[model samples]
Target: MSVSKKKFNLVVLDMAGTTVADGGLVEQAFSAAAWQMGADPESMIGYVRATMGESKISVFRHLFGGDEGLAQTANAAFEAAYGERVAAGLIVPIPGAREAIERLRGEGRSVVLSTGFARVTQDAILAALGWEGLADFTLCPADAGGRGRPYPDMVLAAFLRSGAADGVQEIAVVGDTSYDMLSGARAGAGVVAGVLTGAHDKAQLVEHGASHVLGSVAELDGLLGELERSS
Candidate 1:
């Protein structure tokens, strides 16, 4: 379906897998956290891999069988491990990610970088990548009332905070996971695009409600252009 360019004035993007490449750090950190809490990492890895775009605490809450205390401790450890890796310079932007954000903004869109990680870990990544102010704003679960992907809170938060879009239908959401697609769809975004650069595959993305699928976020601006022409 073709959409008007004016329909997507606010762009919400996922951080880790969509814009930033962390080299499987999330799984590694999950393993470390599991081990620290006396759980077998192998036993929980499948679920971890399946829910890539979910908030870490939420993931832990499920893994720990709704034990909030255990979930909190595990989440803290995961953040710490991930933070250390970021401090060691272990993350990099997906090629053209920075350029994509610039191009989107250049076209008068308000770009928001959203993440499933806690604020501290997200901040570490921004600092490491020198992306402190690359987007109009950044969001984590806490910024959106402690809910994340698969619930739509973060995406809705970005829409409300940016005020760049007149309504949910004016928002564009791009990410690399099924959960990201779900969040965007649930939030009633005009365009929920999935990229192949991270976690889930094309089928998974489509199954989760992606309006479009692209090779990478670098193609986002081009996709918008295509949408304009088709419209």
Candidate 2:
């Protein structure tokens, strides 16, 4: 299926869940970090879930604000824990993830893998999936200059890097969280697609500003088709 409409030339996708199969690893990492930092169970869980697609440090700031030392400590611990978990080769590309990306690229659409992870972790994920060079651009918060998801830094970075600055009207942002949808909307991306293969449900995604809700990244072609026809 064609994953584009009249002018969609870029598809910015999230790392975990959208491109990579998460399998609850992100939640587990957050829980471990929260516990290690002596954060309150209820509040930590709430904040982590609430900010599912933002940077890990961003989530830490939300959960353990006012205490930079503690938040930083917890952040390091979370990265370490997540790194270990992922290094064990537990992570894989979501089913159809490779196909979706390949198909999109084959059609000459620029594909960027944008994530909440640090650069190191993002590289690790790409390596684990044997997709080290698959994406035309692989980016994270650090690469964005400032801020992360729920903000447009990452998506805008994609726009600039992919040479879509003037063609922002042809950009699409696809991820599994409200943060991704909100970010895309903020970036003025013509297509903001939320997939249900990760942390969010359809209702949650729609509530957050997703113009298209997909079953998973595998259905990206369908999403592009629907949005195009609706246009």
Candidate 3:
């Protein structure tokens, strides 16, 4: 499948595994959350791993059989555990991630960082990385009406809030998870790119909906350049 290139003015990037290296903190936190909720961590780990970029709350809701109260409590536990890890400096920006954002912004693009974690956890990550205002905007599921990856809501919200592109086809979405690719494709982004620094591999990413597969977020600027040249 050949994809025609177009210049994108809005860039929506996934947080963990794509731009931030959380060092498997998500699974660790999920295990703790599950145990706290009287669920077997080993039994739930597979689903947790499979839904890497989906909203944590949504994952809990599924795991808890649609019991909203249980899901909410489990999600709170997960967020607290994750936030504590972030506060402990367990997370780091992916190599050259900050530089890539700066380069895109320098080239007149608006960059928005989106994540499946809650807002509090997202803020903790930003605070840990000292990236309080690095991107034009930061988003979590709650900010986009409680939907995350595999849904177009957050991407669409970024597109609507940034006012960076005239249409969805002028937007670029990059992440490391298949869910992220699906979200981008569903949102009709011009460039639905998958990076290899996170959970899912190239095949899974492409299988879901990635238009491009990159080695890492660092390569994104080059991808955009290549697209521009082809255009």
Estimate candidate 2's alpha-carbon lDDT, on a 0 to 1 scale: 0.84
Residue-wise lDDT of candidate 3 within 102-210, one digit each (tens)?
Answer: 9988888889999999999998899899999999999999999989889999999998888778889989999999899999999999999999999999999999999
Give the runs in model 1 whose Cα sits over 4 Å from its true position. 1-5
lDDT of 2 by residue, 109-184 (tens): 8899988987878887787778977988888898888589999998888888777435777988999998999999
Positional deviation of residue 17's Cα in model 3 after best superposition, in angstroms:
0.0
Encode model 1's per-residue lDDT on 1-231: one tens digit a residue: 223357578899999989999999999999999999999999999999999999999999999999999999999999999999999999999999999999999888889999999999999999999999899999999999999988999999998788788789888899999999999999999899999999999999999999999999999999887886787
RMSD of each: 2.9, 3.1, 3.7
Error of 1 at 8 (Å): 1.1
| Model 3 pairs in collision | none
Give the Cα lDDT of each candidate.
0.93, 0.84, 0.93
Model 2 scores worst on lDDT over the 10 consecutive residues at: 1-10
**Candidate 1: deviation at residue 24, Å?**
0.4
For model 2, what is the error of residue 118's alpha carbon versus the real structure, in angstroms, after optimal superposition?
Answer: 1.0
Score every model by TM-score: 0.97, 0.92, 0.97
TM-score of 3: 0.97
> Candidate 2's error at 187, in angstroms?
0.6
